[model samples]
Target: MSHKQALIIYNPLSGKRKKHSAFPILLNKLSEIGYHLTVNEINEVNNMNNPIRKACTQKWDAIFIAGGDGTVNQTIQFLAEEEFRPNIGVFPFGTSNEFAKFMRVPNNIIDVVSVIESGCITPVDLGKFGNRYFINIAAAGWLADITYETPPFLKSKFGELAYCLYFFKKLLFKKPSDNISINISDTVFSDLSLFLIMNGNSVGPLERLIDEKICDDGYFHLLTYKKTTRIKLLFHLFAKLLNLSKDLSIIQHTKINEADFMLPESISLNLDGELASVNSSYFQVLPQHLNVFGSNKNN
Candidate 1:
């Protein structure tokens, strides 16, 4: 068989300092593996979409994204629109590679490259929120506000710790809203505090926090927590930290293909890691929309 042309789009600012140091070694290994590869280093954030367009216009077998969730989100926005979508290969150099966890891609560069060269592909689902596409979770209410409120300097220095610190800070000052209503298919749930819709199994580093049930079965999980006091919120947080499902008493969980959230007022939403908000929002699953290059593992 002829060699496949691959394009590697990476962000230099992602992952740990040590992981970033492995780039040259990864490049050498890719060369040794006989892939006709092109490497594009992303300096500015706006430069992300341009490379995807350039790669699409050329002859390439796969587009390898080597950054965090934000970079992957940007690349997906472009690829999902194209008439000819090439296979997507992921190098999880991001801080929280939630999508990579769902796809079961190893964190090591060599192992990831081996999976890519293995030539295996699988059809996975994608979530659509308004006009954008999300591969992991799209969250609204408290979590969204916390993510947006996090400082860039903190994020740059501490990575995922920024989110943790922000979460605690929000818990002290921010009160959960009780005016949100969630409509999932035939069921209508009123008086929700938070709405977390997940397309992947894991939300962050810990696997069992969100939903440990069924993640990649071509459906999105709808997790809504009832409005409660800060004490209850603390309990829930502890439960998430401990991976205890029984402590999730305030949370209502279900699976659905389509859902809508009607909020009493405008609120922010977090898709992957990007932030946005609207008074009303709609979500639907794009069954098998993303052709991810990875192992045959069932998410």
Candidate 2:
């Protein structure tokens, strides 16, 4: 077989720096499979508005990202707009790893290396928020802030627990829910507490939060939680997470290709674990926007 070229983009701060150990192993494995590799630390490179965009601007056979959802989110932002984008390989080293989990990419580095060798690629849809693209979710409301505000030191020490700690603390002193308006295909939803534009089945610890079958369905799901008390909203979220009941009338869900939102200045959307603040935003689904390496089960 002919050799192929690939790029490896990683974040030093994600997932307790596990990538530092797995990277050399990945290098060996890729070399064994005849892949010529180029490596860039996402945080270290300062040129071209960060290395992810600069590296992705070139053509290659594949690009492997060894970081958490935030790193992958940055990489996709550039690749989504490129015509000669390479196939994506994600080594899920971040907290939650929601996009990789939704894509069914293996959690361990060993399995990911094998998947890369197998050459299974799946086309996946992405949610475009304004000029940005998110692979897993775009969220707004009280809970969204936890993803970005949690200190990096806490995440390094506690991993997922860091998010949980911040969550409970915020829940106790939670502010009033924003009275937001969203228009999706002529339907308007107002007075929503939590707004989630989901492209995948999981968000943070909540898995299969949306139908697993519709993950790549060319349209994104807009879920609005009615403005309710924080305790009640938590109950509704857990109920949905457990699939505990069918009478989830408190939550409104719709699938659409595009939507418009009017949000409060205080509320910002969390796109794949990163913060994006906007008073008004437009969201659209780019169907099958990127190709990623994953098991056949995901396809």
Judging by TM-score against the true structure, name the best candidate: 2
Question: Judged by lDDT, which candidate is best?
Answer: 2
Candidate 1 lDDT over residue span 78-97, tens digit each = 77766667789888887777
Superposition error at 149 for model 1 (Å): 3.5
**Candidate 2 Cα errors over 4 Å, as ranges:** 44-58, 278-280, 296-299
Model 1 has how many clashing residue pairs? 0
* RMSD (Å) per prediction: 3.0, 2.2
In candidate 1, stretches whose alpha carbon ends up further than 4 angstroms from where it belongs are 41-49, 57-59, 210-216, 240-249, 277-280, 296-299
The lowest-lDDT stretch of 10 consecutive residues in candidate 2 is: 46-55
TM-score of 2: 0.92
Quote each prediction's TM-score. 0.86, 0.92
**Can you write out model 2's per-residue Cα lDDT over 1-299, one digit (the tens) per residue?**
67798888878778776546877787888888988888888776454555455545666788889889899987887778777778889988887787787778877778888888898888888888888888878888867789889899888888899999998888888774688788877878888888887876566777667775455679877788888877788888788879886655778777878888888877878898898754349988888878889842543
TM-score of 1: 0.86
- Scored by lDDT, model 1 comes in at 0.74
Residue 154 CA error for candidate 2 (Å)? 1.3
